[model samples]
Target: MTDLLLPLAFLANGLAAGVLVGTVLGVVPFYMTLAADSYVRAHAFAVGRYDPFQPACLLVTFAADVAVAVTAPTTAVRVLCAAAGLAAVSVVAISLTRNVPMNRWIRAQDPDTLPAGWDMDAFRRRWARWNSRRTAVAVLALVLNAAAAVALP
Candidate 1:
């Protein structure tokens, strides 16, 4: 069980971290630079692309981490996996509470008919900040998973 789960955890964590860093580096800065109307379109497009995919990857990481934590032979490996799971949970919680709502709001907006007094600047800033937080946690989860793999028998 440990043998199977450790690799699965690593794979999911890697996928989650890759996408998070990609957004943290690529689409986020570009979207932030766009005007409000343009941002709505681009942000909605990006959000649609992610949809269930990113969330699934993060969930896989958490599930695998939990399995590894229970099944790993040594205390060190188990502890590492548990820590990794904690980080994975943090990433999921942040996405649910912060990023997902902002993404949904952007998807619902009509670029041409945005409500008056919409605050794109603050919205983008808050979204990016939450993204950065989750990205950092996902990356840390990857590192902790790696350490667990190394500590395994």
Candidate 2:
């Protein structure tokens, strides 16, 4: 019932959430990316497809990332969490700035339309890279958070 225990518990929970997301996302990167890509290809601008659903997932992932950052006991643990968070941040940025717009455009298009100036190959490649990086970050974050919870008072 100490302050450290409470934070540690929170961190632990975040780690669990991160693991769950990593598993699901890792398995279906193409579906996730294509859905967003398709949505933006149809729409004219970024509206963040899967709006309600995606935010919750992101919240859990980011919460874990932040919890580890604050609760980790050692400098090395903190640095690891920080690096993971940076990777997560990059994924989030790419999703918002690049993928979301593309998804929005995709949503607006007919199957034949191809959403104006959409570049399917480029989007796929970029998303694949970002997703891979994000997954790595999430995995590292979970490890660091778990380590922190164990090491911290």
Candidate 3:
């Protein structure tokens, strides 16, 4: 059972990492190409779709990191698992601090009829900047999780 847990944990971490990488490389770029209203609408739609699955992925990955640390076969494996867990925590911190508020602000606006004096360009720029940073953090977490997996005996 302990042996099986490591592989399952790795699978969960890998799946979460793949989704994060895909969002950075695929979804964000596509969203950037749209007109302001379209971008708003598209993102709102995308978020609706993404919210269902992404949170589960992150949770599983985070939980698995803890599990790995608990079941680690060696000191090095425990350290690697702890590092991976820290990285996962960082990803959550970035999302809550940077991404969630921005998303909430975006969701509050009417995509079809943005309010007067709305600074669409600023919104786009800021969102992009924060998203890029979040993506980088997620990538680091993914790498750390991968390292932890490799260190498992």
C-alpha TM-scores of all predictions: 0.97, 0.51, 0.87
Which model is ahead, 1 or 2, in terms of TM-score? Answer: 1
List the pairs of residues colliding in candidate 1. Answer: none
Residues 6-113 of candidate 2: C-alpha lDDT, one tens digit per residue: 354345435444543553465335344455445344333323334444435545545555566676666765665555555445545655776566555555566555
| Evaluation by lDDT, superior candidate among 1 and 2 | 1
Angstrom error of the Cα, residue 54, model 2: value is: 4.2
Candidate 3 residue-wise lDDT, 34-79, digit = tens: 8888888887887777655655666676777777788778877777
Relative to the true structure, candidate 3 has a C-alpha RMSD (angstroms) of: 1.9
All candidates in order of lDDT, best leading: 1, 3, 2
RMSD of each: 0.8, 5.8, 1.9
Model 2: lDDT of residue 144: 51
The TM-score between candidate 1 and the true structure equals 0.97
Backbone clash count, each prediction separately: 0, 20, 0
lDDT of each: 0.90, 0.51, 0.71
Poorest 10 consecutive residues of model 2 by lDDT?
42-51
lDDT of 1 by residue, 1-153 (tens): 999988988998898899999999998989878988899999998888875788888888899889888878899999999999999989999999999998998898889999998888999899999999999999999999999988887
Cα distance off (Å), candidate 3, residue 7: 2.6
lDDT for model 1, on a 0 to 1 scale?
0.90
